[model samples]
Target chain A: MTLVKVYVTYKESILDPQGEAIETAIHGMGHNDINGVRMGKYFEINFTDDAKDIDTEIDTICDKLLANPNMETYRYEIVNAEGAK
Target chain B: MTLVKVYVTYKESILDPQGEAIETAIHGMGHNDINGVRMGKYFEINFTDDAKDIDTEIDTICDKLLANPNMETYRYEIVNAEGAK
Candidate 1:
């Protein structure tokens, strides 16, 4: 089996209110050095033995569902469990 | 400034309905090789110059808000924008 980790984040043009809220809370907690914060979604996917061309499969998965191309950007890394060196 | 990327995911014991829905959709799209999927929260934090002991700060931040101790697990990596190579 292989595990693919995908990170999806708001596009640079999108405003992130949740992140702003977090930043405010951090400041109130005395973390005065913090400049800003942004938030997004993450996913961990496991591929069984039947999967082939994992990269292409993930690209399709991201484009089709994992991320909204209009408002978000995504990147992924695959961890081959069998090759856990 | 430096950027810290944080990923907070549901603990193995937690059931992820959102991920299950995605997996079902993927299967509908014909990618039956996918076994399981899990969802999580992602954050990008920027640290201004006054910040020190980033690891400790992040540990506090994650423990304080980024994650739910009872249900989520978090990990982070620091990216030094100034040292980009």
Candidate 2:
């Protein structure tokens, strides 16, 4: 089996209000040294060994359902599922 | 500066409805090769050079805010911000 780890995050030009809010909350808890924070989404997808065109499928899945191209960017790593476990 | 990447995910025993929903949607889109999916949260935090007790602070933040101890677990990697970029 193949395991894919995907990370989706906002583009540099986009404003991440949720991240800012979390940063503010963290500062309130007295961790003043933490200067910045950005929030993102993570996904782990498992594909059977027989799956065809894995790379193409992953990209299509990310573009169609995992990320909003207008605001977010995504990247992924494919690894053997057995080794991952 | 220090850069920390935090990943938070549901514990093994927890049911990930959102992940299931996404998987269903993907299959509906004709990606039958995908067998499993897990959704999680990711955070990138930057700490200044002057930050004290970095490791301890990270643990406290994760325990208190970044993850729910009852249902979620988290892990992080810390790296030099300059080198990471």
Candidate 3:
């Protein structure tokens, strides 16, 4: 099995209320110098096969379904995959 | 400045259509054994100050703003933060 970790985040132009709230809270907690905050998501996946065309497979996944492409940006890295190279 | 990386993801029980689509695409791309996919987000923040009360500040950020506390889960690690200990 191979493990993939994917991270998704809001586009810079998008207003992130959650991030804004966090920034405000942090500043209120005596960290007045904190200027901004942004929030995003993470995913950990396990693949049972280590096929040769892994990158292509992942790319298809990303383009076809994993990301909205308009609202968010995604990046993934291989963490580990036992027996899948 | 100190850097913080935060990740947010859906709870396991939550349905992730994006993840499902990625999984299907991967399986179709000659990796039939691929079973599941989950999607999430990532954030990188630069703090301008190295205040002593960093953890508490961050906790407030998380509890009050960074995470929904209902629909998603969050975790963060410090990657780098010059002059912030």
Best by lDDT: 2
Docking class of 3: medium
Cα lDDT of model 3 by residue, A1-85, tens digit: 7877777677778888877876776677666757567777676767666455656766766666666688878777876566233
- In the range B1-85, model 2's lDDT, one tens digit per residue, is 8999999999999999989999999999999988889999999999988987889999999999999999999999998768443
2 versus 3: better DockQ goes to:
2
User: TM-score for the second chain in candidate 1?
Assistant: 0.90
First chain TM-score for all predictions: 0.89, 0.93, 0.77
Ranking by TM-score: 2, 1, 3
- Give lDDT for model 3: 0.69
lDDT of 2 by residue, A8-50 (tens): 9999999999999999999999999988899999999999878
Give me the iRMSD of candidate 1, please: 1.0
**Candidate 1 or 3, higher TM-score?**
1
Estimate how well candidate 2 is docked, as a DockQ score.
0.92
lDDT by residue for model 1 (A1-85), tens: 7888899988889988999999999998899888889999998888987777999999999998989999999999898877321
Give per-residue CA lDDT, model 3, range B1-85, as digits (tens).
Answer: 7877877777767788987876676677666856567767666666776555656666666667666778778777875556232
B28: Cα error in model 3, Å: 6.7
Q: Provide the DockQ value for model 1.
A: 0.85
